[model samples]
Target: MKLSFLVLAGAQLGGVLGLWPQPRSLQTGSSVLKLAPTFDIHVNVAHAPSDLEDAVSRTKGFLRNDKLGRLIVGRGASDSAAIQHARSLNTLQLSLVHGSVVKSITDEARLPLGTRSEEYTLYVPADGSSATITANSTLGLLRGLTTFEQLWYEYGGQVYTVEAPISITDSPAYPYRGLMLDTSRNFFPVSDIKRTLDAMSWVKMSEFHWHVTDSQSFPLRGARP
Candidate 1:
């Protein structure tokens, strides 16, 4: 809102508020304000509430604070519906990449039936100065929160600041995108599946193909063989 400069630690500091500069865009004085009719925001991967927060925060840094907004969080197919439901309440706009939508904000913590621990994409509104979030698993939620912190930390607190009409175009390249494991070939952990799913989402894969039939019976417990 205001701009001033002071010399401390042999470096000149200014009271300018702006998005942290990145390779993608210019860094103007932090005090710049954005005027917009629509906003289009994108978050590649979000599986926890914290990730939603960070994405919202980064988005705010780039645009002028709006009274209403939309948020889209995309996750792997295995993500629980409960996580996505939790994300809907606070967002000015809410949508899941491939996640389900919940009917009410009051029930944001409901996960999908028979989903695994790390499979979820939660979104929350960035309308208020801050949002309130609750997850079925406290630890899982914490991990999501940490993700937002990391995005800010890694980018030195520069948020995604821009003033553009809200429009987004996203679609998967394949009909079925998924995580595949050969249990008979080798035993892979859940984390590996999470990682693979994340990669698939980036490439717009919406289906999962599990080739569990091998010479030996590794017998993966989650999927029916």
Candidate 2:
């Protein structure tokens, strides 16, 4: 039914065809939706994180600037008229609410330091208006965005398209879902670690255990890693 790669929402994100780790509950529909070039991202709650905007920007930028998939555009053209014509687009509203972020951490929205709740619900309306990602916290929102990225694919020499009228309810089965790397036995560069962390975030991993210090080696000693 398809011919080419979907030009990827981003290297670190996933979509409908292959939502990483798979949500607990998911239901899709027959209708399809198109993401306009200037689609907006809006949050419901007040005082959201700075990272939220940046993350959304990076996530959506992949669709706008196509590097390889330009069959629709002529060889020397700077932009795609098909994409630009739909500048009047609807916003992808993010309805983010606060839940019990963590049982241990008391104060509200200790975003950077503590383990926050990561449960989220994604809704794409059948009528194709105000597609929303509802979540209990910013952490949950991050997870929802990752799943949203995977839903889109390049359709008929075009990009930023997805099957709409879908709903998903997702949460980690275990709070301590984690991945540990035994770096004590081997040395890893910062670039390698960054890529690994991105991959971890894509799968919604709760923790990463960098086993840096063992009896024999201390690669991350005496300096910040």
Candidate 3:
């Protein structure tokens, strides 16, 4: 009787401890599973510089993260002294903002800039797959990354996967980017100007002209605010 009582207690403990075999369907239903996409990036660079090692390393970190998409950087002219210098600095900045590797460095890149057309000519990869980013300024390139970030964040924590190729042909028609500021017509806030400048940087636009006339004195008090 005592042995039987001990066996009963052991069985009860086993059941309480979940040692009893569970049905396959029940166990399967409790299992957690996830699906993720893969990425393949390509980069094209027109120049390369000596100080690009650290930048490239950090960029590789960004590319390898699952949240961010794949990236590839190709160099066009790594040997050119002038181009190399420019790329060294720009590549560093690009890596900090966008994780793109400088893959191929070459010296035979020619960008077209014309005065008549309003359209901007942006050199992008063919093939109709993968995101193509082209920028004349490091700041503009950073802005592109910000734009991508915004889009990705909007879609929750899902990774951005793209297989479609992009063919971008862009160029600015205006020789000088212009800004019209009218402090006279209406009271303008300083914060507004700062925000506008931030937006302007995204497009690689420089403020060539500012028309801030303080003629209409509605209430000028803050000493050239």
Candidate 4:
């Protein structure tokens, strides 16, 4: 069984940016900041967790457009889970600091049954001086990160920008969220499965039930003794 889960928090923005799955509480912003080729992201912490570091690394690549080189994350903090305090110096720089890091993304999935922690809060100041995202686990962080990415848009056919002065605090309304996919009746390739997973993540859906085998066919490859 392939099971995935997601919980949404509330969101508030300063302006109307119309986000998917609509954050529980969102306040849209007025100003918009363009993502220029020179835009850079810097992760600042004392001892960073591997997972947080990895997230930042991936974020660098995801934010990359055109020939913009890969971004680098600075080092700080060591705790697996800690609150981060950061400030952006200018429009060209973005800073992030977390209180603690989650060692693995799967860690949230391992919580005891009925766990309701997949929540996160994000703040993008109107001044654009800095942005902040806070969560109890990396799962929420990931969700917030996805939301942050969704905020960016391509303008003039080449530039990307996000509405400024946005704030969102999101959490799931239900304790258990899941999606079911039957692979037995209709074959789905690995890429398709991944796409489904991505879509689920975007909507903060937590559960992914993969029906790999059914009465129609049993194609699952079991471990050989």
Please state every model's RMSD to the true fold in angstroms: 17.3, 7.6, 22.5, 12.2
**Cα lDDT for residue 166, candidate 4:** 77
Residue 104: error of model 4 in Å? 2.4
Error of 2 at 96 (Å): 2.5
- lDDT score, candidate 3, position 218: 51
Question: Which candidate has the top score in lDDT?
Answer: 2
Better of 2 and 4 by lDDT: 2
Best by TM-score: 2
What C-alpha lDDT values do all the predictions have?
Answer: 0.32, 0.64, 0.33, 0.58
lDDT tens digits by residue: candidate 4, 119-193: 878876755465677776666677777677666543232333334667788887776678999988998899999
Q: How many clashes would you count in candidate 4?
A: 51
- Residues 1-225, candidate 3: write the lDDT tens digits: 999999998655431122111111111111111112333323344354432333344333443452532223322122223222221101112321135333321111112323222231122122223344455433334333433222211013332212112122334434456566666666668898787765564443545244555555555456775
Error of 1 at 216 (Å): 2.5
* Model 1: lDDT to the true structure: 0.32
Prediction 2 global C-alpha lDDT: 0.64
Tens digits of per-residue lDDT for model 2 on 141-160? 77888887766555444454
- Which runs of model 1 end up more than 4 angstroms from their true locations? 1-92, 95-154, 161-166, 220-225
Clashes of each: 29, 5, 32, 51
Q: What is the TM-score of each candidate against the true structure?
A: 0.31, 0.71, 0.34, 0.70
